[model samples]
Target: MKRINLSDKVITALKSDIASGKLKKGTKIPSEPELMERYEVGRSTIREAIKTLAMSGILKVQQGSGTFVASKIKSETLAQRLRRADFEEINAVRSLLEIEIVRLACLNRTDKDISAMQDHLIQRKKAIETDQQQKCTDADIAFHVSIAKASKNKVLVDLYQNFTSVIRDFFTKRKEENMTYFARSHKWHEELALAIINRNQESAVQLIKTLLNNNY
Candidate 1:
């Protein structure tokens, strides 16, 4: 079994405490040292966990004042909210994201970005040939994420990264028989990389539309 990271464990413990009302909203949390001892983790682990909670709006950090529970209910991040969306809804949003990503990528992409896409495509092909479902899913996502990065839009890249987690889950739940889709879509993916490399903005955009519409 994989060991959970220490900071993640602390985060879960803290959230549980909040949910049970042991750490009520508006109450200041223990000092860093106290938290370290309570969780039996190092100071860095405690700090990392607290920082994550703060980012999620579960905890409020006031410099020199200490941290407090901002809400008994954890504020949902966009990625968390996305987990509830159906595949169709997520794909609709994906279409919007990728269209703009490809457009920007065509304009901004560097040779390094093109290399990343090509490498992922190779991994994708190898995964399909070896019938490695997980690798195929990873490479497919990576290929698109490379495009998002190539676009030079940090916000778009972050959004796509979150959206891909839900997509990864979708890939895992699929029946083995559905592996055929990966095989069939490989050529389209190859073409997409080529279009991006060639800086053919229109071709890249059209390919993305077709890829998304085909439900691949």
Candidate 2:
């Protein structure tokens, strides 16, 4: 078995402490040196572990003061929880939401909504051609958000917004890691957009599913 990284091990220990109430909410965590000695890890590992906890809202760092348990520990928002979720879990939830979004958008989308998606699609293509990875990711997400808005369900739209924020990190990380799972597919995107524009619910749902499962 692959050995767990020191930072990850420290994170696991900290999380366990919190869960067991050994580290209560609003209580300060042990200082860096204390943590390093306790876990037998170096300063860098301790800092990295703390950074991960901070990002996940499990811990809060007060500059020049110390790290403390967040006031609202383990009660992470949906977006926050999703941010910490594995890619498979995030993708599964996204696929479920987007399938409904495509179907509803096909039934309820206005011409303006179609135009918005088209504009974002154009932007995405441009970003891809120029090899602007971040821009491409932004435009692609914008296009999906436009589709969710077209569904005209406020709850679904809000959920999609939160989901996008969580997934944006996935896109960025994949790009950095040289993974093609989330790469842009202009052709499929255009086809899906056209299906929504034409009010073809069946086609739109099929296209969206195909696009998501294509893994490229």
Candidate 3:
């Protein structure tokens, strides 16, 4: 089996052990070598599983000490949960996030940030012109991700990155005929970028709202 699938199995096994009280919270887990022996996988696969669980708040790793069970119940990360969320739910949160991001970006964006946003928009336009749905979707997300980074808020940038992954998945699953949305919204994205470059907070926020209203 592939290493990714192997790591997933290890993660599931570890979670099951924790849920079953076999690996109690606050208890140190088996060493890397021990885990490798048990799962019959390489050290890298076991380490990847541990890392993923650690990020999700299931396991905790201490440098030079050991890995330990942090939670008895599985705590799903935002990225994991977002995959299961519907478009309406994701969009509602995204709308709120984008509005705030654009507002802050307008105030905080630097020449570098503006240049990155402009580059993504250029790629987005090219993707649309080529009728490459997946590339268009990627470029669209990149454009907004640049905006989020310009917010000068680390938390917002992380949340938007995770949330946009879900949006990217949603876009990929869409039929070819449904991809007009990306093309239609390209102009609005250009306008939003310009608004941010001009540091027009009100106009940036309103343009984001318009994009959201039009289901872009």
Candidate 4:
């Protein structure tokens, strides 16, 4: 198997995102040179990266109009493809990003942000106690998102939102196999909430990492 180059790491993200409609079908991505610059990789790596999607039939090369996506709407979305991603790989990236996000959020969160998070925590608690697992799950997401939003950085919020969808789906399936997961999640989230509220950045980041790594 050919290995992916570290510098052009964006190749996979771009390909999957284009197929997922995050980049939008029919939308022309930046040219080979632009991608190479962004990824800080050589020309050959960029070409090889583009070749992956080309081979997958998701990208169509038109001589004048440039590469266009497969016109079918369903095919443009990569949710099905995401389902096939290696969980170990996904979790590794998730861990790296979320830890820092929580750290930043702790430093930036305002009093109002704390209030919003508290409200989400309340909703989360009520949902679980009332046996509304689906609602509880959603509330759990809301709580984490509120914290990310409190970071006062749009990029973190956006990336968190995108990746968390996949993470949420993972937990949802895990729930089907093990119902008790929610209770432990509740306990951990409580600690997370308190850590963020206290502006204890290290504590918040640590708890978040612990909770995330527990899945494995």
State the local distance difference test value for candidate 1.
0.89
TM-score of each: 0.67, 0.64, 0.66, 0.64
| Residue 51 error, candidate 3, Å | 31
What lDDT is obtained when candidate 2 is compared to the true structure?
Answer: 0.85
Stretches of candidate 2 exceeding 4 Å from the true structure? 1-74, 176-184
Question: What is the alpha-carbon RMSD of candidate 2 to the true structure?
Answer: 8.8
TM-score: model 4 vs. ground truth: 0.64
Candidate 3 lDDT, 47-120, residue by residue in tens: 99999999999999999999999988755688988998887988899999999999999999999999999999
Candidate with more favorable, higher lDDT: 3 or 4: 3
Candidate 3 ranges with C-alpha deviation above 4 Å? 1-73
Question: How well is each residue in 1-216 modelled by candidate 2, as lDDT tens digits?
Answer: 122498899998998789778899999999999998999988988999999899999999999999999944354477877788887987888899999999999999998998999999899887777778788888888999999999999999999999988767766656764224334468888999999989998999888899778643
| lDDT by residue (tens digit), candidate 4, 87-165 | 8877887787688778888889899988988888898888777778787778878888898898888987877787767
Q: Per lDDT, what order, best first?
A: 3, 1, 2, 4
Please report, in order, the local distance difference test score of every candidate based on alpha carbons.
0.89, 0.85, 0.89, 0.75
Better of 1 and 2 by TM-score: 1
